[model samples]
Target: MSKEKESVLEGFKAFLMRGNVIDLAVAVVIGAAFTNVVTSVVKGVINPVVGAFGTQDLNMYSSCLKAPCETNDAGEVVKGIPIMWGTVLSAVLTFLITAAVVYFLMVLPMAKYLARRARQQAAKEEVQEVMEVSELEVLKEIRDALVAQRGSGRNDPGRNGPGQSTP
Candidate 1:
């Protein structure tokens, strides 16, 4: 393969291997599955609760925009403008519920965890920097002490050099 094609393939491989990309793919799959659950809840639980005051089926609720709104025997509107507000309301409720659950259960916790991890990483870096600086300072102090001792020893007549004996 050409170098350009090889590099592009390598880049694509790296992108696929990234954790966030995998996470996003998983989320999409799970979201699709969760949609069925959310729909069931809205249809079974929410609709029944609303049905206490009116019809059990949310799809049945509607408002007449025109003067003579009517539906045929097959439940299809044959004349006038029939605004199906209940269907819209049901959709809105489902969206809100899904959003609330995802935010509270997934997004919020992940955000907090990432924040904590970042703080911990920053603290660890700061400690490493401090340790490096302190180690350097200690090494410098030791060198200075050794130099001072060597200078003092050389000036003193009592201590001899490496090969010289005291006369």
Candidate 2:
């Protein structure tokens, strides 16, 4: 029926609008932006520190061999290849800086936050379970009392026998 289809569509829409899904989307966007900031920090701040050691930028440090490798206008080497150690050094430095920043600033804090949140959620669930069990126990006690009262033998037409009807 069209009504059933409308209900199903409404339910799906509600599910998508839940807090968890929205929070996840926001986190993803923020995480991407954070990555760009970290990358730029590594390229700008960290690169300069490494460049202080008499290196014409990290990308130019290389061990050359037979010839001072000649490159065409398109930056392509025509004859011999230059052992580009500078590029490798720069990459290594960038990787190390990025790793350190991620570990200290993002990973550590996120881990601690998740651990704390999990502990709090577990405690809340345990309390809820205990309360539910207590409520069920009360209901069971009332049912048992009613059963016992009906089972007790009685001649009154309005009252049931112990655990039985008095019709």
Candidate 3:
């Protein structure tokens, strides 16, 4: 009934508020923005450099099975089924560039940073352990000293109390 509906809405609210969901949402938004930059670089810089050596646009390069691909204002098919190999090549190149940038700029650095943090945490733990061991050693020494005093009768309140002199 209405109780089930309320539970479902509460579950949905919890899902939306989860840290992973929020992180994923942020990452998608940032990725979209980054995609635009990468696309611009591919179109503006990389494409032009590649075009200098070959065709003006890589996307324009294609293969026609019918022999003639480009036609001059004819109502008929210009060429065979044009397989746009150039566009595919362009897409592949863009993918490679994006992967390389993300790896080097984000993933690799994040991995290095995480490793460094882990090392630091390990070192801090070691220091704490050493300090704890030293403290334990001091505590044992104090305990042993008190035991020795008691055995020697110096710790006895009646025999060698702080205010009374031993006869």
Clashing pairs in 1: none
Error of model 3, residue 18, in angstroms: 1.1
Off by over 4 Å in 2: 1-57, 65-80, 153-167
lDDT of 1 by residue, 29-142 (tens): 999999999999998899999999999888888888896887789878888898889899999999999999889999999999999999999999999999999999999999
**Per-residue alpha-carbon lDDT of candidate 2 for residues 1-167, written as tens digits (9 for 90 to 100):** 69999999999999898998999999899868876876687667766777786653677677657587888999777777689887887677667766787789889999999999999999999999999999999999999998777565454567654576645
Decoy 2 TM-score against native = 0.53
- Model 2: per-residue Cα lDDT at residue 120: 100
lDDT of 3 by residue, 18-84 (tens): 9999999999999999889888999999889988998768887877887776665754455567778
Q: Backbone collision count in every prediction?
A: 0, 7, 0
Report the CA-based lDDT of candidate 2 relative to the real structure: 0.80
Compute the lDDT of residue 15 as modeled in candidate 3: 97
Which residue pairs in candidate 3 collide? none
